[model samples]
Structures are given as C-alpha cells and as structure tokens.
Target: MDIAVTLEGLGQGFIYVVIGILFIWLVKKIDDWRTRDFDDDVHIDDGNIAVGLRRSGLYLGVAIALSGALGGSSKGFFLDLSHLLIDGFIITLFMFSSRFINDFIMLGNINNDQECVKSFVQPDGRKVVGNTAVGMVEAGMYVATGFILNGSISGSGGTFVQSIVSAILFFILGQLALLIVGFLYELITPFNVKNEIKSNNLAAGIGLGGILIALGIILMSSISGPFTGWANDLTSFGIYAVYGILMLLIFRIVIDKLLLPTTDIATEVKEDRNVAALIVVVSAINAVAIIIAFSM
Candidate 1:
C-alpha cells in the first residue's frame, strides 16, 4: 500500500511538472511576441531561458510538495488534487488560448504606427486573466465539494452536476464583484487611472494581473471546501458567502477612500480605474473566499 501511494505521488508530481512547463513555454512565447516591434528589423532578446526554467522548476517543486502534503491529509486528498490539477490545467490552457483570439480580434486592424494600441490590450487582458483565474479556482473548489458530497474520492455524476452548478454560480458572483471593484478603482485611484489611460504598457500590466489571478484561483480552490468542511465539523461555522462579500466591501472602501485619495492624478488621462479596483477587490475576494471556504 505504501509503495503504491508513493508511485501515485510520483505520477501526479510528473503531471504537474509537465503542466507547469507548458505554462512557462506559453509565457515565454507571449513575452517574445509582445516585445517584437512592427519593424521585423527590430532586435529582440528572449532573455535568460535558463533562468526561466529554474523559476518554473521552483514553482513545480512547490506544487509537488503541496500535493504531497494534501495527499497525506486523507484518502480523499489525492483525488481532490487530481481534480484540481486537471481542471486548473484545462482552464489555464483555455485562458491563454483566448489571448490569441483577443489579440487577433481586437488588434488585427491597426497598422504598425498604431502599435501603441498594445497598451490598450492590458486593461482588457487583465479582465480575462482575472476571470480565468477565478474560474480555475472555482473548478478546484467544485472538485473538492464533489468529493465531500459523495463521501468519496472517486468522481460521481450527481456530485459533479451539483458542483458544476455551484461553480458557475460562484464564478459569476466572483466576476461581478471583481468588475464592480475594478470600475470603482478606476474612478478613485489617480495612479491606476493614469496607468490605464495614457500609459503605453497596459497589456504588460494586464498580463501580470492575469497571471496573478490564475495563481490566486489555484491556491484558493485547493483548500476552500475541505477547510470549510473541517471548520463546520469542528465549530459549525456558516455564512461563507456573506463573509466573502463583506470582506470585499471593506477592502473596496479602504482602497477607494484611502489609497486613491493619496495619488495625484492631476496630470494623467483616461486611467482605467476599473482594472485597478478589480485588482484590489479580486485579491480581497480570493482571500476571503478561502477563509469562508475553510471556516464553514
């Protein structure tokens, strides 16, 4: 039994490593594409491929360790990890794939001189990134919830159906919260607004935000349901949705009233307050979701 479990861990670890490598490759390709100018003559440095590999390896190691820790928690842990990895990987691939579509659909018509439009790409891109990240996280939660509902690690049709419904509902609510905060941020934060407007680096910032969103989703999803189950079992905690919403509202007010007021936006134009707000709110929501998921 011990040998089988160890072999399973190794197998799962290899799978995660492979998925991480693919993401690394996609990130590199996007970086290269973004840096290339309209003039094919412009030289582009791909940057340290070795360094990239090393960083990805580090992340992979962390993920593997996390998986091991989770698996050791119970018989259901391995099954949950499998679901999380599969769903997370699938959603991430889809999210990145959509970037290509967006690049073509949104920016296909502009001439080389108009390449400054790349900056516009970020504001929009961040939304996609944020949305995708949330989706992935929700997927992970549903996977765990499914196990809980069925009282087993093996997937079930009834549990899966309910989980899918729950995930969709939760995802929509999450996105709505993110979008509202993003809009508010645009209105209040001079720094965020200026960066959104006249800044020429929108797409780059959006890419970063999107990646972070994905990371947040993965982290949150991995533990919310089980944590909630544990908490409920121990303390009968409840009201998770309300707690998440309240946390978001509090954070939104703080960012809008305090941080935005400090920024001097007198000189900046057309800043994307929405994206900025979205960042703070999504981050808060992600954090709170984990808390509630575990607590209830």
Candidate 2:
C-alpha cells in the first residue's frame, strides 16, 4: 500500500474512534441533564435496574447512529468530519424526539420514563424499585431507533442536502414502521401486551422490545447504501420495508414452532412471566433479521 493512503486511512480510523467516544460522552451529559429529576447515573450507581437498562439502550443506540453517520462513503476527511458533526447534532435531537415518541405513541398509557425513574418503599423494610419492564421497553425503543437512524444517513453518492432529506423521510417511515410493528405484535399475540407490560410482566416487555430491535436490523438494510435516483430508491425502500415486516411476522410464528416447540410462548410470557423463554424469542428474531439483512 502507498504510505500516504495508509496513513490517511489510519488517521480517519483514529479520528472516528475518538469522535465516537466524544459523542457518546456528550450525549450522556445531555441525557443526564435532560432528565435531571430522575438522574439515571445516580440511580444506576445505586444499582437501579430500571435506570441501568434505560441508559444501556441510549448508549448503544447513540453508538449505532454514530457508526452509520461516519462510516459511509467518504468525500474526503474534511467533508466527512463536517458531516460527522452535523449528523451528530441531528442525531442528538432525534434521540430526545425518540423518547417523546416512545412515551406518547408507542405506549400511550404508560409514562415510560416515569416508570423507570421513580421507586417506592414497601411495608416490611423492602423497596419496590422502578419497573424494569418499562425500562426494557424504553431501552428497546432507543436501540431500535439507533438502527433506524443508522440507515437514515448511511446512503452515499448524494449531496449533503439529499442525505439530510433522505434521512428525514426514511426516519419518518421508520417511526411509522415501528408503530405498525407494535400494532401487529399486539394484534397477533394472545394476551394484551400493553396490559401485561403495565402489570410489570418482564417477559411481555422483553418480547416486544426484542422484536423492535430485530425489525430495526432488518430495516437498516433496506434503507442503507449508495443512493440511486429518487424514484427508484423510494420504491426500493417501500418494497423492502413491507417485505421485512411480513417476514418478521412470519418468523415470529416459525420461531414459536421450531425454537420453543413445547412451550406456548404467550402463556409463558403472560401467565408465567418467563423471561428466559422470551430471551429465546429475542435471539431467534435477531438471528433471522441478521440473516435477512445479509442475504439481500
């Protein structure tokens, strides 16, 4: 390899890592400030499972979005750096917007952060902490949004304006897709998912949250890559989104049969609160999504 090319690649790689760390750090500060009333870091230090889970999702999600923003086709170091900063800011705003979306749209009845933030004491010197179930859902939403955001800005061979416009449109579609996924999930499942989650059913929350992330992985493939003509790209994304959703739905049933042949997933999740069983469901969903993403 040429010395200049090798050194330039090394420099780019180094800056990316540094920038990625800095973004994560900056977002954490912003997040902590945004919800100072809850103080996730403080509670996390105190072993608050809900805060821990919530924070975990946000961190991972931010990283995912950053990777997509900075790792795509490069126009040069300066251009890439400019895009990184711009996209990072946009992503930060979207991160907060995602919380609002999760609060109002995904689980309208539940104040998700409220559930994750507050704790209470019991009669016999016991503490009933914040709801891990709600935390899981919140976490899942962030993680899913991370993947969606990644796809939104990952396209290349286009102007910055084009990329921004594409991201905005694709992100809107992603939000809609997520909502549809939630609706379809509730529609097909035997028990009422929202009610189950409200009741602190960890299994139910895990199942829903895990599926959301899986769907995001599948969607990223459809939305990412070099941009072609507007009409062609839009059509491709629409077809892929529908196809991915349908396949996920089908896989839900398939996993139930093949992975958990003996266990009734609904009963386990709703009645027994079997988190282990739901974990199996999550793993299988993610596995299938990754397969579909790569196979395309």
Candidate 3:
C-alpha cells in the first residue's frame, strides 16, 4: 500500500475514535435523562459503573465494527472522508434507535426505571448497587443491532431507494432474529427474564446478554452482499433463520449437556444467581460466536 494511503486510513480511524467517544458521551446524557435519577459522575453511591462500562463497550464495539465495514468497502486503505462522516452520523442515529428498541424490550417503555438502578445481594452477601445485569443485556442488544445495521448498510450497493428498502428489510429480519432468541431463552428458563433482571439477578442478566451478543455475531456472518430482489432476499433470510435456529439448538445442547452435564444452567441462573456458571455459559456462547465470525 502507498504510504499516503496508510496515513489517510490511520487518520480516518482516529477520527472515528474521536467521534465514538463523543457519541458515548451523548449516550450517557440520554441515559441519564431516561433513567432520570441516576448520576454517572458519582460512582460510589447511586452510580452504576457496570452499566456505564457496558454501554461504553457497546458504543466502542459498534464504532469499530462500522469503521471496519467502511474500510473494507473502500477502494483502498483510505476512506472517502465525506462518506466516512456521513455513514458515521447515520450509524450514530441507528445506535440511538437501537437503544430505544432495547429499552422497549427490556424495560417495557422508553424511559428507565428504578428497577434498573436497584441493588442486588451477591452470593457473598455484599450489597451491590445498580442493575448491572440489565446493562449487560442492553449492551448485547446494542452490539447486535450495530452489527446487523453495519452489515446491511455495507451490503447496500444499489440506488438510494433500493438501499433504503434493503436496509429496512435487513433490520427487520435482525430484530425478528433477536425476538426468536429471546423466546428461546424464555423457554429454557422457568422464570421471567425481565423479572429476574429487574430483581437484580446479575447471573441471569449476563447469561441472557451473552447469548444475545453471540446470536448477533452469528447473524452478522449471514448479512453480506447486495440484495438481488425481494424473492432472493426473503429466501436468503429464511435460510439464515434456519441456520440461526440450528445454531441455537447446538448452543443449548453444548451448554446444557456437553459442557455442564452436572449443572442445570438455567436453574442455576434463575434460582441461585450463579455468576460463575453464567460466566461459563457466556464464554461458551462467545467461543462459538468467535469461531463463526472467523470462519466467515
């Protein structure tokens, strides 16, 4: 590669990082507004560091993913500055919308609740304040939405109208996939996920959140290339949906039967707040996601 091209790429990457930081700050402000009573600056008292960190992670991950997509689609290492900034803005809007959707699913409203800021009792009897578990789930949703949108935007290579339609279709498909995953999670557990997370069950939150991110990673692999037409697009989505279901089944079998044969993973999460077990489950799902991401 030309030295100038390399320098330009690095410069654009730095710009993305700066924009991402600013975006995170705006997200924090919006979160504070939505939550209404929490103060992010005071970490020791009413502040939920875990929530903040998780949100930051999601923002940063999405920024990086979007940047990578832009880099890949560019003619060389360097991105068109106009396109970079434009797409960055678009992605930022998508992230905000995605957050709203997550809140709708998890909180049942666009506004945050005290339940999300409630404290939980750990296995060691420590009183941990803030619903970090909910944060985990939110993070997963944000990251997944980012990946899906990023892939969709990158894949759109036609006229503006066509691209818009394709992006919308892909986004809808991604949301449906998330819903199916959530349903499957509910089936595996005997308790209500929202209630469990609202009760400050970190284990349950992390387990559920990890599965969402893992599913998103797998779904990202399937989102590539321009849409041929509605028929082809629907057919491709159906195939990916089947693949996602199969992957979920395999994930369940591996976690429940192969990895933790002696442990009832769902029961552990629902009843015991087994953070360690949740970690193991999350790790397993992420391992599969990594393998799938790399293979693609």
Q: 1 or 3: which has the higher TM-score?
A: 3
**Residue-wise C-alpha lDDT for candidate 3, range 1-296, written one tens digit per residue:** 79998897688778767766675666567656765566655653556755674556556656644653464455443434555555555666666666666777644632334444566686678887667777777777777777776667666556545655665677778877887887777776667877777767778778777877787777766776665777886787668766765686577667776777777876787778888888887888888776866675
TM-score of each: 0.41, 0.93, 0.83
Prediction 3 TM-score vs. true = 0.83
Name the better of 2 and 3 by lDDT: 2
Q: Please, what's the RMSD in Å of model 2?
A: 2.3
Every model: Cα RMSD to truth: 10.6, 2.3, 3.2
Task: Supply candidate 3's per-residue lDDT for 160.
Answer: 47
Model 1, span 150-202: residue lDDT tens: 22112232354444443333333333333343344345443443233223333
Could you tell me the TM-score of candidate 1?
0.41
Off by over 4 Å in 3: 32-36, 44-47, 75-79, 106-112, 121-125, 293-296
Compared with the true structure, what per-residue lDDT tens digits does model 2 show for residues 206-281? 9888988988898888888998978988898788888888998889989998988888889888767888999988
Candidate 3's error at 84, in angstroms? 2.7
Q: Relative to the unseen true structure, what is the C-alpha lDDT of residue 170 in candidate 3, on a scale of 0 to 100?
A: 73
